[model samples]
Target: MTDYTSMANGGLPRISPYQAGKPIEEVQRELGLSEVIKLASNENPFGMSKKAVAKCAEALNSSHIYPDSNGYYLKQKLFEKFGYDPKTITLGDGSNELINLIFQTFINNKVNVVIPAYSFVVYPMEATVADAQVKTIPLKDWVIDLDAVYDAIDSNTRMVVLANPANPTGTAVNINKLKEFVKKVPHETLVVIDEAYNEYQKEEDFDDTAKWIAECPNLIVSRTFSKAYGLAGLRIGYMVSNEEIASLVNRLRAPFNVNAIALTAAIEALDDTDHLKMVVAENAKERDRYVKYCEDHNLYMIPSQANFVSIDFKRDAFPIYDALLHRGVIVRPLKGYKLDTILRISIGTHVENTKLFKALDEILKSLK
Candidate 1:
């Protein structure tokens, strides 16, 4: 047999696959535990909205038909809800697909993309896939340093990718700072803000990119139904941008990229205000409770505006993660993000949070 690895692009060697949180079923089987709580992946602990569920069931009756290639109904509903022109919208299998499509639309080997150092890892990976250079700006005080990011931009910079309520840290930049950065960026460069956790933002000064995108033609805001909407399994996300840019992105997208059920579910999920409110409220309460627990336990944690928290155990987080897993609890270890002493935990239900705290308390006691 021939070795196929040699035929691959040289740049492919530089890419590291994204690591998602471990599944609860796998952990349960491995540990032989009947019950397990997964406080990982930043997933909404509350189940999906009833309206979305009903719509999905309705879609099942037409499961034999292909999804609307243009995602017409969902786009129309999104336009009505968000007030963006339908022509400016582009749907994706998920926000991840939207990230990849952005590179496909605008990137070339000669172009370079700028990203925050500790922001979403997908930005760098997508740039690498496009064979484009990546300039990573390190975060200052656990928040994106807009000044530093501005300094990194140059004539060759084609895109700047930022994740508000950034993952692994959950910090957000102020509206004034983000607006100034947007104003200073060159017109030729595309500014992409990944707002996957926008619904969870609690800060008063959080930048609303939707409002700014109206003035900045080069801006793109990516959002998903996975977080507060509780539709991760369906993999539906969309990008709002200038009509011209959206056209380019649409050209790069696969036909029927979103499934029939997902399109229907997402449209219904938008009308689920009660479910959205409940998730937002529960997440806020659990997040505060977790933060308090961290403080009381003397574990240093970053102040988060999202549903997840990153806590520094002042020791190797891997051992604690393994211990938690053995106890039927799953949390994300941040070793790959270069924070070996930290673990990221998503906000769960009150009962789940109690179990996590109990497991951690026991683990900490054993460690000492």
Candidate 2:
């Protein structure tokens, strides 16, 4: 038989699979734990809105039909709720898929992509997968170095990614700073902002990229139902850009790329402002609690506007993470992000937060 693996593209073998936060079932199966509180994946612990649930059930009746290829009703709702023109929207299976789609449409071996380092892992991964030239610039003080990013751009640069309220670290730059960076970018180069946690940010912290696209035609802002809407299982997200960019990007999208159930859930989830408000408000409370805990205990943590906090454990975070797992709690360890001493903890409900700290205290005691 032929060696099929050797026949594949050289870069195909180099891709590392994404590590999602452990599922509740996986923990139960592996450890036989019944009462697990997972704060690993920045999930909405409050669960989805009742309105979205009802819409999902209604969508089941028409399960035999294909989803609307353009996500018409969802886009219509988005236009009404957010006031963006329909021509500016491009729907995807998730913002992850949208990220891939954007690269697929613009990238080639001839041009390079400028990745904002320690941001989303997918940005660099996709650039590598496409065999596009990749240039990575590291963070300064755990925040994206926009000045360095601007300096890296050249005639060969096709795209530059900026993750607002960046993942893992969960820090956001101010609006004026963001505008200064965007204004400096070349008009021909695409500037993409991954805003998965935009809804979780305070009004003052948010840059409102939805409004920015109108004036900056080269901008593409991607968001998901997975974060604040509690629809990760549904896998729906959308991209916002000017008509020209969206039109080009949509050409590369597959028909019925988004499922009917996800569409229904996202559409109804928009109207559940009360449910969204509750989720964001609860997240803010837990985030503040963790910040205070860090201050009182002399533990260092990033001041986050996103739904999670990154704590510096002053040593390897893996042992703490494993100990927490054994105690029926789960939090993220950032070894993959090359921060072995830092653990990123997603905001949970009041009960879940209490359980996590209790586990941490016990584990730290045992280790000492």
Candidate 3:
């Protein structure tokens, strides 16, 4: 038989597949439970806008036709809502696809990539597949150390990745400091800010970094409807860069990469600011509950701007995770990220959170 593993790219064989959060049905089937609450994936617990859902349902009739190859109307909606130039927008299945496109476009063995530790796993995964040396910088005080990241960049560094309101840790970098850091990076090096959870941030802390693309042509901002817009199931997202870079990525992007239903849902979702406001507001309200629970229990919860909070249990947390599973409550374990003592829990609805707290109380008491 042929040695298929040897035939693969240098880094492809070494990469571990991404582990998504456990689903409700999977837990129900395995545990023989009738009810399950999932607080693992950082999804909008409130769910998608009714208007977007209706639009998607209507769009199903036209699914046989291909999606707009250019994502024209969605780009127009983005331009109207946020003033993102349509010429500079590249739609993808999700921001995940855009991140991969960026790595495929710019990374190679001769170049390197710089990212803070505990970044969205895709950054390093894509860079590795492109055979680039990944320079992982340690976070300072649970936040990205911009100075350290900047210092790590060299002439061969092709890209620098930052995830505002970072995942797993649920910490965000100072926006002004991030801008200054971007300005300091060399023009030849691309700076990618993955704003996957941008909408969950407080208004005072939010900065639309897409506005900086004209000034910093090498800057690329990727965002998703999967979180605040509650369109994760549809898998729609887009990136903003200079027209030249966008055109380059577009050349390589598969036609109709974003499906018809997703395009329609995103357009409607973007216009439904009322629904967006409700989702973000509820996320903020529930996120505070997690903070208080951590404080009352003496577990340190990382201050988060995203829809999730990572609690440091200060001991191996796998047992707690397994216990929660048995109780029909699913949260994420960070062992894959080498964070054995921390569990990242997505802020769910009030009822769901209450169930988690009750289950957790029982589990913690049993330990005593």
Best by TM-score: 3
Model 3 clashing residue pairs (backbone):
none
**lDDT to native, each model:** 0.89, 0.89, 0.91
lDDT of 1 by residue, 129-235 (tens): 78899999989999999999999999999999999989979988887889888977988999999999989887686655877877888889999999889889999
> Candidate 3, residues 34-142: lDDT per residue as tens digits?
9898899888888899998999899999978988899999999999999988999999999999998888888888899998999988888988888889999999989
Per residue, candidate 2 scores C-alpha lDDT tens digits across 1-368 of 99886776635567888899898889988999998888988888888899889879988999999989999899999999989888899999989999989988998778899987788888888888778889998888888888899999999999999889899889887778888888778889999999999998879877668788767888999999999999988899999998988999899899899999999999989999999999999999989999888887678998888888999989998999998998888889899989999999988999899888888878877888
lDDT of 3 at 180: 94
Cα error, residue 189 of model 2, in Å, equals: 1.0
Instruction: Estimate the overall C-alpha local distance difference test score of candidate 1.
Output: 0.89
Give the runs in model 3 whose Cα sits over 4 Å from its true position: none
| Cα deviation of 182, candidate 1, in Å | 0.9
In model 1, state the lDDT of residue 280: 92
Best by lDDT: 3
- Candidate 2 regions with alpha-carbon error over 4 angstroms: none
Clashes of 3: 0
Clashes of each: 0, 0, 0
lDDT, ranked from best to worst = 3, 1, 2
| Residue 294 lDDT (model 1) | 86
